[model samples]
Structures are given as structure tokens and as C-alpha cells.
Target: MAAKRPVDRPRPTLLIILAAALTLLTLQFRGLQPLDAFQQGVRDIVEPVRSLSDRLTDPVQTAWNGVFGFEALRLENERLEVELARMRGNALTSEADTELLNRLLSEVDIAYSDFDAVVVRILGQPPGNFSSHMIEVDKGTDDGIEEGMAVVTGAGLVGRLEQVDRSRSLVQLATHPDFRVGVRLVTSQDEGLAKGTGTEGILRIESGVRLDAQVDNDEVLVTSGGRSLFPGDIPVGKVLDPDSDADYRRSIIIGLAADLENLSFLKVVLPAEKPEGMR
Candidate 1:
């Protein structure tokens, strides 16, 4: 017997597949209702598998998204923080500008409103043993600021311009030991000399009111303007106490009206021609 020969099995031709696809397409285009039912049946069989696959992968996709989204959330938070800080800075600047404008307006409304004056910002405090006794202002002789000119704030007297340069002037604070101003009691109509005690925000009255004169606590003191240093009626301070002896001469302590520690803006009274009929 001869060895058995292998026979080749027949495979479907490409033409047969093309014919089958064309048949399905033609049936579908012709609105064949049976083809639609057959397609729906196939989809129903595949739908359960797809739904199960999505359920199996859902937690893993969620965890992956959370891991990546955390960084995105962190970056967003940092951006917001920077924006908030910028807004806060702008708010502070606006508040400061408003305060400065109000202060300048108030200072302009004082007794020197009609007088020629210059508004100067305090540049620094001079350095030395008298550092506490004086502050530096941004105005100088070039701006018509001169020594002996009085410095004042909206509240009251701050000091007198002492050393003046071309662009800056030093203010001798009224609290300096040698500082003196003629003051009059508002209530008693008595005049007195107020002297600084080398202490901050304090003054001592001397050589004006006699011991027999009536002086009371909390009495307001204003400049007498006798010596041409300060304008008359500028507030000096309030009387704290009276000190009198057998000589019938009295001295009193004064609490300053201006808050020296927080001085920022001031007015320098310029020398002007004395008005007719005015001292």
C-alpha cells in the first residue's frame, strides 16, 4: 500500500467575504427589519461584558485620578495664597494713603491755613545725645524753611526748626531741656514761660504766673506769641500741677498735646510779611 497523501483543506476566498459584507450592507440600506434584530441581539450579548469591565476598572481609574489631581489642587492652593497676599498688600497701601491724606488735610486746616507754610515729612531723627530731643525734616533753607520757625502738626506744637541746610532741617523738639515757649492759661488768663524738662512729652511752666495767681489743673495752655517764635493761641499742653514757694513765683507741669512718638507729618511756618495792623 502506498503512503497516504495529505489533502489541502479549502479556505474561504476574499471574494466570498466581500460578497457577505455587501449583502449585509444592502440589507441594512433596504431597511431589512431582521438585520436590525440580529444586530440588537449581538449588542445585548456584548453589553454585559463591557459593563463588567468598566466596573472592574472604575476604582483603579478613580485612585489614579486622585493621585494626579492632588498635585493640581496643591498648585491651585498656592496660586490662591499668592493672590490673597497681593490683595492684602494693596489694601494696606490704600489704607496708609488715605490716612496720610486725611492727616495732611487736617494740618492744613489749622491756624496757619492763611499763612505761607510748607508741609514736610519727617525724614529721620538726628543722632547724638540730643537724638531724642530732635527730628529731621525733609525741608531746608532751599524751601524757605529757616531756623526758629515753628513746627506744628494737626494736634499742636511739635518743635522749632533748628539747623537748616539746603535740603533738610532739624527740629528741636519742645521736650528738649533748654526749650522754652511763652504760654498763657486759657481759663485764668495768666501768662507763663513753659520749659522742657529733658523728658519726652512733658513741660515745666516758669516765670509767668505769680504764686498768688490762681492756677488750676487741666487748664489748657496756648502760646502767648510775645517773642515772635510761635503764633498766638497755638495749643501747648494742659497744666498737670502747680509748684509755688515763698518767693510767690509758681511753676507748673504740663502734659504735651502732640503725640511726639508718632510724628509723621508736620507744617513749617514760613516767614511772611507781618500783615498791617497785626503783630
Candidate 2:
């Protein structure tokens, strides 16, 4: 009787209780189906850690996208910039060619057969006070550009060839202080010596010409060949204003018919001996 059945251990009941406690802990930790304060506390603590983890991984995702997207965007930007530059360059070149063509056509129409010449491009602007009104051209003595030869463009007379080298020439613009033209007003047919005064595109017409002369603004002035430095009948400039009493000669200010400030092309005329009959 004393050795009857081994005493049944309470282990099964303890295990059952332990398992229930563990299940309750797991539910609480997982915030599952429990609205208790303990569960809410667990959830609050874990929520911030999870949010931090997602934030930390965001940079990596961004970097991965950049590896593929960055090159495409960078290349596209470069291509667009290059294209824009090319288009601008093309437009500028087209404008320049158009100007040169017009100049050549005018030369032909004027029957300037005495000069064996082609259009030359202006390379750079001059550097001194005189340079502001003058330009350096791509022509030289080797190209038959002689000093004192007249330089003209499509719009009008630009200047006279000043300095000449074997490969280049300097043009003295009509606005230069030394520049003088024996010009006649188109409207009044009044003759005067037009001399540059070295101001903003202004010329002094000798006062001997009538002060009250009815020369309108933009009246065409042309070379009259009085002094013989320039050929006769070449377009010179347009009258900007009539002379005032304070101004010398009540001078008719002149605006150069050619855009001297922005010239790109020019034509040089070789000195031609005036025909006896024409003279």
C-alpha cells in the first residue's frame, strides 16, 4: 500500500498555467485583440522604433533610384544646353550671311566694276577712342586693301580703309573725328562739308549752308565728290537734326546710314581714276 502508485506530479497543471501566461504575454507584446492599457503601452513603445527603422531605410531607397534616374536627367540637361547653344549660333550665322549677301548684291547693282573685291568680315573692334567707331577687318594689303580705299556696306558707306597689313586692314568709321564727307542733303540739295564731332553719332555741317534749311530727319545724304577722297553719289548718312544757334553751322547732325557699332561685313573699293568724261 505504501508503495502504491507513484505520486502523480502537479507538473501538467503547472505547465498549463505557464503556457497560458506565455500566451497572454505574447498577445500583449503583439498588441493583438487587446485594448488594455498594458497593450497600448507596448504598442506606443514599438511604434516609434518601427517609424525610425522606415526612415533610416528611406535614404537607401532614394540612392537606388538615383543610380538609375540621375544619369538620365543629367545627360538630358546637357543635351538641351548644347542644342540651345547650337540654335543660337545658327541664328547668328544666318543673320550674318544675309547681311553679307545684301552687301554684295548692292555692290553689283551699283556697278562698282572698277574694284576687284569680295566682302570681308570684321573680326574685332578697335581698342581706343577711335576704335569705338572703327573696326578691324579680315582684309590686308595682300587682298588689295589699300589705305584710303572706301569701305561700304549694304546699308551705306561705313568708312575708309585706314591701316593695311599683308593680311588685315583697319577701317576708320564715318564717325571718326578725322572723317569728313562732302555731302549734300537730299531734300534741300544743300551742299556742305560734314565733319564728325566725336560725340554720339553726330556730325557738324558747315554753317555756310543755310541754317534754316528744310532738311528733314532721315534725309539721305550722299557723297558729292567735291574733295575727291570718296567716290561720288555713295550713300553717306541721314540727317538727324538741323543746326541750332548754339551749335556750329546750325549743323545738321548725321546718323550714319550704316550700323558702324555692329558691323560684321564690308566691301573695299579700289581707287579708280575718274573718267575724263564723267569728271
Task: Give candidate 2's error at residue 206 in angstroms.
Answer: 2.9
Candidate 1 lDDT over 1-279, as tens digits, reads 956556633355567878999999998999898986685566446645645865698798779868988897788789989979998879978687557534533443434355567899886665457577888777766686767888887667788987776566689999998788888776677887888898888999878787887777766677777675877667777778866443655668999988887567999876566546432
TM-scores, one per candidate:
0.56, 0.52
Q: What are the lDDT figures for the candidates, one per model?
A: 0.75, 0.69
Q: What would the per-residue lDDT of candidate 2 be over residues 1-279, giving only the tens digit for each residue?
A: 555457755689789999999998888678665435554456446645645865697698679868977987798789989989998879978687556544633543433334544488886664456476678777665675667778888666778887665556678877778887787665567888888777755676765467666777666677666575877666777777765453433656788777665456889865566445421
Show where candidate 1 strays beyond 4 Å. Answer: 1-115, 244-248, 272-279
* Pairs that collide, model 1: none
Best-fitting candidate, scored by TM-score: 1
Q: How many clashes show up per model?
A: 0, 3
Off by over 4 Å in 2: 1-117, 126-130, 244-248, 274-279
